[model samples]
Target: MIKLPFTLPSRPPVTRIRKCDAAQLRAPAGPRTQPMRGFEDHFVDIVDYIVRITDEIWMERAVGRIYDTYDASCTIYSSYGVVRSVEEVIAGTITTLNAFPDGEIHHLNVAWSGDEDEGFYTSHLGHSRSTHVGRSSLGPGTGRRSSIRFAADCVSRDNRIHTEWLIRDNGAQVRQLGFDLHEVARRAAEADTLEHFIVSPETRLEGQTPRKLLDLPTDTLDGWARHMFHNIWNLKRFDWLARYYCAAATVHAGGGRVAQGVRNIGALYLNIQAAMPDGVMRVEHVCHSEENDGVIVAVRWVYEGTTAPGGVLGECPAGKQVFMMGVSHMRFSGDRIVEEWMIFDELGVLVQGYRK
Candidate 1:
């Protein structure tokens, strides 16, 4: 049974539980409490607060307000190593907005784990749209447009975001930087052929990571997921998709990438292999919780490899080696996966692929 968080003053009971339909999996009602001041703790609440604080800080150009919204000791992990302080976060925000000038983030959905009293954690998936007018993360002005997707996993306590894991699509960003996607891929392939070097993460013995968060069906969904990834990415067996994914499963790769059904999912993976042959994925963090609604599994994984001939995006094999950081949030109805939302650094991959 799922119960509302007890940390905040009681919220009205969920009233009635909705039917168990994959289509009905939507954001829970409005956040438990509304943000009265700009600095109020926004991480515990749902989409509204996070989005509100984001707008106040970026759209409104109120960067200093983060000192109030984020804990003094808050730690944010991203492509760059851990951010040093709330001040750095503010600086980073300013740097990003300067490059895009009119940059705006649009959050689409949020899923959460834990509760207010202990600590509230939220997984936010969204995208950013804007014109690259000034210098941004992608480098000097290219005068290009952008529609890059990103994701955030944050935990809150006492109304301050305590920790976070942020991922963005760098591959897509590289394209927006004015380089042709195909050209980047070709460059990566040519470099790889000349160097004959590739980057990959060390694989560990399976079952090394323990499962203690929630119960699972007879199939052990958590183990099953890890196994499928091992075979598909490590063992090089894409055919395993027929068993793990439902016929109607939907695979969403944020940053303007999405595919539905097993056929499309298979094709996507195949495309990925063509681009980064011998690429391996290693799980860093895993959480699976079965609630009144259904089962949700969130896993943080990393992929590192060299670009090859069968790149997924418009890029061709450049043989440039790179590592991508990403997270996968999946929902299951009964035993099979019904839907998924995932993230990776698209721009970072391209930069590495084209590196001389």
Candidate 2:
């Protein structure tokens, strides 16, 4: 099994993934040295490999492609549960496509690291628009159109993904589909046992050194991400929003909620903090790409704590601990972050908290 919460050695903060639009991203990679051997020849680079494979499997509706793109022993971890094996991945794909026949995901950006020799790790952000035309885990067809955000961090070798951490903005989808988020979670939790809700070792972060601004280097993307997450979220430094982000910065806080400006962004975060007063956030992974004028960084993080009653998540059972998995993509111009896409599964968190 792939180890969780492993730290990668820091590299000199130089350019990596490039900034490009959908059209540019899909354009021919052109002739270049293939970093990954044994990969498909059409994939000139790692980004192209990830984007194209995703398109082939999801958008193209080629469910069989999973057999080719994922290793037989691949495992997918998410807040709801773990999906093991390529066969399970294929089955899940079929089920999803069956529910939303017209579902299509638009890839926003990809931040990646590693090399062909060992393996490449990628954090891919996607925006999905779909209609609930058939029965699904959410229940029967509602014929409602839904838009949501999701992110996946994957490790690949020899043209096949071996492990993945996937998080979807499920609360957004449920609301768009006109379902009661809490009720849905409560029902699902009833069927599941308490053992499933226990926090895994991978999500624990107690007894660690405090991540102080002065102690952590901010020149590198890895350091910068750690600093921002620890100081702002863990330390409850709301004032740092202005100090770290641009005044005009925009945050896409999943479920179609977009907050513009530092004030609004801080408010979005405060809403969550209000629910879990003692929640602690820890960065599990970091990757970045340098563009012409700025940098784009992707951070995978986890938060855990008890929930207080009457907040964004509504009433919670006393002493109920919630574990949240999230992926955030930030675009930095100079020293300030100009844009961010914060994605997490609020629906899953509710289920975890409500599960008895």
Candidate 3:
């Protein structure tokens, strides 16, 4: 049984994260945060850099800009697989653009940390809308329009992105394209061309030395995030949801599904937990930024376990170990979460669980 939503009155006020607005984010170039020494002159800040480059590459049809934005040996771990080198990145982008033709990604929010010297890391939340007008890995044109949400975490230094972790709601896209999820997976498995690489926490943070924090932050958002995953997700403590979330909290879950209340949020959460009942969630990275309504927190995580019977994937347990990489952005209203946006590639997971 679910309990009534409760609040913590003794929680301290939020003050660390600086408040930002869309206008300021899209405003003319000027330094607002850390110094961007090697970055382009037009980029005001890291957020602007992320937002503009994406728009230029996707919307403006300037594919060549990738050469300037990404390093020569940049690596990208995606819902598909690991992408190495700028050439592969360029080719993939061209293929996607060719397929969609009119596809465009709108940047929703960017939660980031670090400096230009140590490399700034950004968790970018985006919404993409497009029409399948040309051929793609999914097959020939279906002439269907689809909208999905995606999250990408990128590390940048000296004006070039070095590493990135990207995940998209491929399940939602497949459904929107009017294809059977299991059928798609089976076909992909038969093709046997998919890399099936899982982006684990260690791979996401490879070769990066940890920097000591000079002054610890007072905000407990990080602690709250850990408790949500460890206790609620791992320990199956549903009763504790009310303590960390608002009664009317809304969750924009994977596959383009939205839950209106805390109960529905639990239902969505239960679906993933049930899929990998024995899976352990490992939080890879966490960052928060002040926004209009409250503080927005970004979390990158991986869930590893064997597939079980009667999960959301609509397939019985096959004893296949699956690693699900996901990213979630939570909007906190003071101490309690008011809204959450989570993105994971369910279609890819289904493919991973298939054996034929």
Candidate 4:
């Protein structure tokens, strides 16, 4: 037994876990510092860590900070696959920054879990609202702006990050940048003709396992995560939105996709089911936090189903099977949940579907 020091709900089918203690739950919510060479005794506030990641590492072009904040062997997992080593992360980081040189990422909120002993993890959901003025990923810049949403979960150890899982709204970016997804899809295939982008076997093994499986919800986050996957979503009871979410809640489903309030979010669900009536969802991993009054949860999940007759967007249903990997970040306020940020590989969905 892990001895979490908290009592879990015993409800039949789905049990809700109770909070550990008022005092512990209210423990220091702010950042703390730890001694580390070359870091000048930097505070371990994971939020601060996140700030440096965006401001210093990405925007400021302080590539050396990556080495300072990330362990030499840090591994990053994304739709593209697994990336290991600080050098790889540095190269990829430069590539992304090159794509959106003027792009600045803003954080809506963060769900943090774990301690330095086991490694700290931050489930950060936010907006990368910026313009495409540089020549990179999307090819030449259209000088157009894009407000892409992203969800990144990272684990830090030895005063540095060692693992990460990042999901972004690429489809929204391509479209907002005034480019056709099909064109990008075609280019992606051509670029990968040599299987150069495939995930390495070792990297695959590293990514398949999660580092710190904790979130901000103390105990109940797990129950909500489990219920959403096993019941509400799988059963397609869109009405359950009200039961699980706040009346004025916001749903940030990435790719510039958003729905406000329970009713509107429920409508999006309807549209989703309309596209993939037989969609099946599976929860690959769920991490929750226990330190704050509210819970921040990050869930790694997969959706698989064939397109319905109407299909998604304007495509006709050819019974083409589509699969997508999504990372969802939810913040709970009181009984019902408040805001949720979600992102998946929209480009991957189109590629997989159109290729068939």
Best by TM-score: 2
lDDT per residue for candidate 3 within 202-221, as digits (tens), equals: 22246656422224233355
Q: Candidate 2, TM-score vs. the true structure?
A: 0.88
Model 2 residue 107 lDDT? 77
* Candidate 1 lDDT over residue span 139-192, tens digit each: 568788888777788877665787998898766677657766556544544444
Using TM-score as the measure, what is the rank order of every candidate, best first?
2, 3, 4, 1
Q: What's the TM-score of every candidate structure?
A: 0.68, 0.88, 0.85, 0.74
Tens-place lDDT per residue, model 2, 1-356, is 32212234543332123444666666666664556787988787787788888888888887898898999989898877777789888878899999999998787777888988889898988889999999887778999999888999999999899999999998899999999888888887887532353573233359867545647766565776788888888778898788778899999885567899989988889887777777878799999755454567899998878888765576766577778889998887656788899998888888888775
Clashing pairs for model 2 are none
Segments of candidate 2 deviating more than 4 angstroms: 1-29, 193-214, 291-293
Regions more than 4 Å wrong, model 1: 1-49, 116-118, 140-144, 180-200, 203-224, 274-276, 286-297, 305-310, 313-322, 331-335, 350-356
Backbone clash pairs in model 4 (N, Cα, C under 3 Å; residues 3+ apart or in different chains), count: 10
lDDT tens per residue, model 4, 41-111: 44445555565456667556888888888889878876545677899888877887777778775655565
lDDT of 3: 0.77
For model 3, what is the error of residue 148's alpha carbon versus the real structure, in angstroms, after optimal superposition?
0.6
Candidate number with the higher lDDT (1 or 4): 4
